[model samples]
Target chain A: MRVVLVAGTTATAKIPEISAAGADPTLVGHTPSADAEIIEYGDTVRSPVTPVSPTGCPTPAAITRAVRELTGFDVLTVDAGLAKPTAAPTIDVGARPGRDIREPEPVPTAPGAFEAARRMGLALPEDELVIGETVPGGTTTALAVFRALGETFPVSSSLPSNPTSLKEDVVAEALESAGLSPGDAAHKPKLATRYVGDPVLPVVAGLTVGALESGSDVTLGGGTQLLAASALARHAGAAGDLTLATTSYLADDVPELESAAAELDVDLVVTDPGFETTPLDRYAAGEAKEGAGMGGALMLADRMGVVDDVEAATLDVLSRLDPQAVDGVEDGP
Target chain B: MRVVLVAGTTATAKIPEISAAGADPTLVGHTPSADAEIIEYGDTVRSPVTPVSPTGCPTPAAITRAVRELTGFDVLTVDAGLAKPTAAPTIDVGARPGRDIREPEPVPTAPGAFEAARRMGLALPEDELVIGETVPGGTTTALAVFRALGETFPVSSSLPSNPTSLKEDVVAEALESAGLSPGDAAHKPKLATRYVGDPVLPVVAGLTVGALESGSDVTLGGGTQLLAASALARHAGAAGDLTLATTSYLADDVPELESAAAELDVDLVVTDPGFETTPLDRYAAGEAKEGAGMGGALMLADRMGVVDDVEAATLDVLSRLDPQAVDGVEDGP
Candidate 1:
């Protein structure tokens, strides 16, 4: 399947990993990927502009512009933006003894991009569209988004190889300060984003919704990217044919993602070798529960046959972006 | 005050982060840190003996031995070992699913290390004894240790920048699989460690017990090191002047560390600026917490200070072993 990698931040880093993986991929960024097709977005901004703090958000307009610049496929962006009235208020009550709060606003950017694609009458060459994002602090935002969506998962407690506990604390505090208590699923996703989230959510949610509405197959890339896909499925009221692609580590944790798939009552395909456990086994073992659309999208990709290595596949996708490097391609306008 | 940095892992990929930090810090691995002291812990044994998988345990003995060799400090290893025990076969069984299970048992090595230190009549130094560790997949182990210690915090749900979710999932599954659900204060830490833990637990527990018995001030460095310190405080049933010197991130996310401090009633001090919010705020807000014993230990030397911009105070400490490097005064062995 041809993959169009949508980057939110640090687009360059993902390129080499994708291009080296031997996939037909294109780079949608202001700068050209060294080895892949380069589709320059007019809204290429610096990383610090939207500082990737635990609560910092990415610019949706940039994502929309990037997608518009890259492809002619019909896009559907989900409108998940809600005014973050809680931002100033939460920071006001510094360390006050209280529970955290979150809002449920759909992400704003992805929907806009999708809508623009639809307006342009873009048609997918195939039945499936692989969707992804590049938001800094996305994991923290994913935790908040899951919580905001009424999923009872501990979103911010793991200390992976990186020891950025302070960032996690900042996110947790921001959530708590906003009154989104740990187990309270009453808040909407938009409010949570405003209170303690980034911009990847709405965009991914929009893509999922648009793809489902169009009856097209979609592949969600990365763990946070899958979370966005799950949120979109939940909103669309149907899972459709969505594929969740990411590293093995994510498929192991966050049972809520699986639970969300189950709730959606759809097929699930996980494109990572690490997620070999059966869906039922995951749930029975308390490893994970099929989420809203678990069955439809939760399938594991056998690396041995499909690709030599997932990392290599990602790198290969990155390498395909440079028109100058393509052996048989004509020069672009 | 003097700091002793221990460089255990000799991976070429990992060294530059330390060397560029510009501390002129001492290098303790086979190769030396640039322009500092060099104590070689040759590649006698490969670290992270296991492949980097989604769910795996760290080799704590490797780290402990490296630290012991680098510092010449008395070693206190955990006294537990793991061998796959057959499950009692009695119930109706179907196809046994393909599952990855790791058992970590604490094995305390060299009781003489503790006894020897005591026999030496070693008095507590002006600066507390700071201990750090380098163990791959330590975060997974840290979560297990935290859960084992009866901390109800989500053992693994948050994302820590790294793409691996297996560590997070393993911790979550261990808590649920062991049936040690959260919200029970009566839970025993040892029981949890036996099921889903690594060797670091008991050794850390031993260190806390040893330090309290000796009545000395101590500082636990690194993320996993702090987790070990927390385990020590929780299981040892002793509390005195113990300070946790960890990255700002742990001080923020792992609620158990703070809870352990409160439970042990010890002070918490994070050293990294990027991971620390309050410490960073304190530095920024001009309310720096300065204790007589808390100032930089390695800052006194010309080679000390921000080595390569990342904290090399630990490296500075490692450099001190070569007495000639400091003031040209050679101290005989």
Candidate 2:
């Protein structure tokens, strides 16, 4: 499967007055979630992290690691916009992190991003494209995009407990500050993204359009952020079949996502990694359920007939990585 | 050989008052020869070109084509800084093209470039690295870098006829403008690149240093531009063995290159494509003799025991691409 992993950041994450309710407090504090994911993706087991939880949570990079080990597919990371530099070889789309949704025009690189994505599409190999994303504070922007598209969907959050109320309040405040209501989103799909969305939204929409034009099946990966991309693609008159894939956690958490996908004419594909059976506490707790292309990667592994193999591989990796568990057992005796 | 091909542009190329006597007038007119080289390297024939000459001249990309076709090695193109977007998947270093050499700082990205290159190094495969570059007006900047390193070597030019005098004049004016003379270039190598060089130089130096530190044998590719990199790598106290490789065209054209290599303690390897045997007018005319990692690609192909195969493949490609030559024979019948 051809994969396009888009990464970006929202300065909304840095809003001092905004709720510290989106991403994991630890990763978001040190670096943008995109950078943290990328760093983990590159150096799988021993990546640097400031663990807020006593036992560090399993990074979604585990899924990427599984895909690499089982299928040997390279993950192409796209920097739609980011505040920090990625260690991976990233495709820079000339974008910057969106500062405040209240500013009205947040993603300044929206038009250029669309063109870059279209150009990227013209270069991809002939295969169904699995497009995914990793962006902190994406859900709020996704909510804005959804409302603009007239979908009253409850978006999922990176946090274990969905911060739906907090996200709604922030989006509401941003729209009011920008002098835009949900109805103003009418025909201008791009306008919503420019006013309230993160840098990755318009660019991913462009990628979807470009891939569809190239006659490739497209999969919008991740949760509400991808749903936002689906809405933009539909409004852009995308012709090819489009599917939205996510983790069971995101699908199960975001209550209205099913109807939103139906309204956008996107087929839904959800992967159940059965992290419930795993020894990893984070996946069980739903702390970092899906981002950095984890859901799509799992789906691709399943298609490659190595879903079981990938799961085992991920377990082996995480087992080796969690020093506290190994040390505790060794020292106890 | 694992190859890292770095490409960039200098605004110095667009200086109307500056002699258009550096790069091939034909290829540089249409595209950054670097981008053109990347396209040709990816696809051996039928790559885009604007035919300024009735039959286009042979590009250094021919060397890259020969190596890839013969040895099946991968080419990694690094966008240190570029004026135009490349069709290939480039590792962007987040650099802007130099505005003017007369400005105190020509390449503002030098410090950041060094860091980026080092990071790139950390990510590269643990293998011998073949580092090559393609930058328009690179030789003049090479002269500047060399001068900053306190070397008085006359650099090579891409023009069929070497415009050493004009380049010397330009370098002199630039050095004077930057308020720097040869002696001030002592221990700080990055200083020279910042004052007068283009964006690609420092990054390549960092790549060289990183590869060396990784215990990989490194080969600096192309002509004077690489010599400048060698100077930086040396000053940076590079530990690994380095060999500067280029075409006989560059080695023969530049008088002081041999001594410069000796001073920098880099072993020099030169390849002869033997264009004299071919009926192609441009090859015989010696236009665009070396750049785009051509000479190093040739060396790698030779090491793979396919130099003759690559030469034959190149002739076949050039013959198929040159329309007038094909048309002349077809019309004669």
Write one digit per residue (lDDT tens) for candidate 2, span B1-333. Answer: 557778777777665433232224434433443344433333321124522222344456655765766676655677777665554546656666775686778898887887778767765654778888877778788888888778777777666666677777778888998899885776676787888888888889988887788777889878888988998889888866889988877787876888889988999998876666544335445566677788898788778777767667765544544454334322321
Best prediction by DockQ: 2
In model 1, what is the error at residue B61, expressed in angstroms?
66
**Shift of residue A271 alpha carbon in model 2, Å:** 4.5
Ten contiguous residues minimizing lDDT sum, candidate 2 chain A: A44-53
The TM-scores, one per candidate, come to 0.29, 0.77
User: Candidate 1, after superposition: displacement of residue A151 in Å?
Assistant: 1.2
Candidate 1 residue runs with Cα over 4 Å from true position: A9-126, A154-159, A162-168, A176-189, A236-239, A253-260, A263-266, A272-305, A309-333, B1-333
lDDT of 2 by residue, A1-333 (tens): 556778777777665423222324445532333333332343421124422222345456656656766775545667777665554445666777876676667887877887778766655644688888766677788888777767676677666666677778778877877678786776566777877888888888988888888888888867788888888888777767889888888777776778888887889888887766555445546556676677788888878888777667766544544454333222321
| Local accuracy of candidate 1 as per-residue lDDT tens digits, A1-333 | 323333332221122221111122132222211101121212111111211111111122222222232332222211122111110000010011111222332233333443433321123333566554433234455665565556644331122222235434544655676566643533343344444444445445554565566677766655543554466456545446655654334555555556655554434455432223321122222221221111212221242243223223322322332323221112211
Model 2: residue B273 alpha-carbon error in angstroms: 7.9
Pairs that collide, model 2: none
